[model samples]
Target: MELTVGPNQFFWPAEKWSAFYRDLAEAPVDRVVLGELVCSKRLPFYQDCIPEALAALTEAGKEAVLTSLALVTLNRERKLTADLAAMGVTVEVNDLTALAHLPKGLGFHVGPLVNVYNEGTLAWLASLGAKRICLPPEMPLASVETLARAGAGLGVAIEVWGHGRLPLAISGRCYHARLHKRTKDNCQFACEDDPDGLEVRTLDGQPFMAMNGVQTLSDSYACADYQIEALAAVGVAALRLSPQSQGFFRLCQSYRERLNGTSPAGTIASEVLRRLPGTRLSDGFLTGPSGVSWSAAPAIP
Candidate 1:
């Protein structure tokens, strides 16, 4: 299976963002998704860097795709989405509203942010020139298997959230701003401090969730260690690894080694959290009854 780096989900500084893509172009990854996926307001700060990054990835022989914002409510966001289709690269639709702006027969990509819970949505998206889909993190293995089977017949490639801080929810208000007692407009980009995200503790002081602007993610990084074989058996095209603040190039190399049969998933799993610190790994969303269950190695079937 290929390692496709998902979009950066955090609000990073412009130089850091630029540097990440530069390093990514040299990583052992097959695809690199570049663009802002969380907040549309943060886009302008690093928008100019996209063209250069896109060129770098393409020049390095990687398949690059532009990701639409997960939530697009304003006119500027709508315009941005409209302009994305004209960039000459494949568009990865995180929001369904993007489909309205995409041209017919162009074969756009579906990101994990879209609510593709069942086969019907998969088939419908496939019919609309969707070439590939990264299934939502909440889907169980049973549903993934079924969708992968249906996708094969539709000539569409299926991918899953192989690794990342599971994006649990999105809201209109910026939680980071609220935490700092500031409005979204005047809040000075406070979310950039935590490259991954600020951990949200429970009432009992458990690391329950993470806050990044308007997006809420799981405190644990979602790792699909034991399910790779099952995913491959069901004809999965690739495994997505989300970009973290540090050790991401090394992270990509590890996943590449795992796919090539030279590295153990356990070792790679251990290496990832070593650099990112204070986060557990979970495959429960793929195997357990709920998204919060913690399992190191989950039963695929």
Candidate 2:
């Protein structure tokens, strides 16, 4: 199966953002989707670096696609969505508003944030010129199998969210600002302080969610270490790995090794845990009773 690196969701300094993509151009991934997928306000901070980054990825022999903002409400944001299609790169639609702006018959991609829960939606998107669709992270494996099968007939490649903090929701209001007693407009970009997003704890101090400006994410990182084979067996074409703040290039190599069958899934999972020590990992949304549940390593047959 092919591996794709999704857009960066955090608010990193311009240098850090540029370096991430520059490093990714050499990472062991097939395709790289770059551009601002979170708050549009963060775009200006690193927009200038995008062209060079895209060129680097292209020169390095990787398919580079630009991603639409997950929520486009402002006029400039709408214009940004409209202009992405003209950039001469594949546009990954994270919000449906982008569809209205894409030129007719122009093939595009769908990001995991969009609600692609059923085959009908998948087929409809394919009909509208979506060449590839990354099923939402919350989808169960059975639904994934059904869609993958349908996509096969329609000639559209099906992908799934293989890793990263699950993006649960996006809002017009910035939760990070609200947490700091500021309004969305003048919130001073407080979300940048926590590059990976601030951890939200429950009353009893249980980790619940992560706040990244307007986006709400699961505290536990969603992993597909155990489901790679099952998904490949189901005809899923690719796996998307969302860009995180740390060890991402190595993370790409790890997933690539697992996909190539050079490394066992258990070893990859253990390495991830060892490298990202305090983080919890889960694949329950794909094969469990809850999104936070982690299936134990399968016994060797």
Candidate 3:
């Protein structure tokens, strides 16, 4: 299985955003999906850097893809989705609305945000020129196995969410703006403060979820360290790694080594805790009692 770096889900300065992709050019990932996946308001600040970033990744021999917004509501956003096809790179659709804007017979990819639950849905997307699909992070292993088998038959590559905080949901309202008592339009870019997202805590003070503009993410990073072998054995083509603010280059190397059988299982989770103290790891969506449950022993605090 190859490592596919998903787009950065959090807001950052334009320079930091450009630098991340510049550094990513040297990382061991096979392909990358880059562009705004959350609020469309964040696009203007860094959209100009996309060409440079895409050029760097492609020149370095990585397959570069552009992603449509996860929740496209405005007319401009629809125009943005329609314009993605003209970029000369594969478009990864996160929302079904994007499909309407893409040209007929144009090959595209599907991101994890799209609800691809069963064989029927997989087959339908395959018929729509979907060359590859990253299944939703919340899907269980049995379903993934079934879809992977179906994808193989349909000549489509199937990918699984291998790492990063699970994207739970996306909403129309901006959580970051509401937190600052501002409306979604006049929020003044509050989400940019937290590069990885602002972690939301429960009433009892436990880390519960993270807020990235309108996107809701799991507090614990989802690690497929233990399920890598199982996913690959079932014909998964790639493992999607969501970008984080810290140690991401190293994280890509770790996943690459793990896929190559050079690094053992549990090493990735351990390394995450070492670098980001208090961070938790979960694989329960794949092997589950609950989504937040961890498959390995708890990391030492």
How many clashes does the backbone of model 3 have? 0
How do the predictions measure up, each by TM-score?
0.95, 0.97, 0.98
Clashing pairs in 3: none
Off by over 4 Å in 3: 298-301
TM for candidate 1 is: 0.95
Q: Each candidate: what lDDT?
A: 0.88, 0.92, 0.93
Better candidate number, 1 or 3, judged by lDDT: 3
Cα error of candidate 1 at position 237, Å: 0.9
Prediction RMSDs, each to the true structure? 2.3, 2.2, 1.9
How well is each residue in 1-301 modelled by candidate 3, as lDDT tens digits?
A: 9899998999999999999999999999999999999988999999999999999999999999999999988999999999999999999999999998888999999999999999899889999999999999988999899999999999999999999988999999999999999999898999999899899998999888999899999999999999999999999999999999999999999999999999899889889989989888899889877888899856548
Per-residue lDDT over 145-255 for candidate 2, one digit per residue giving the tens place of the 0 to 100 score: 999999999999999999899899999999999999999998899999999989999999999999999999999998899899999999999999999888898889999
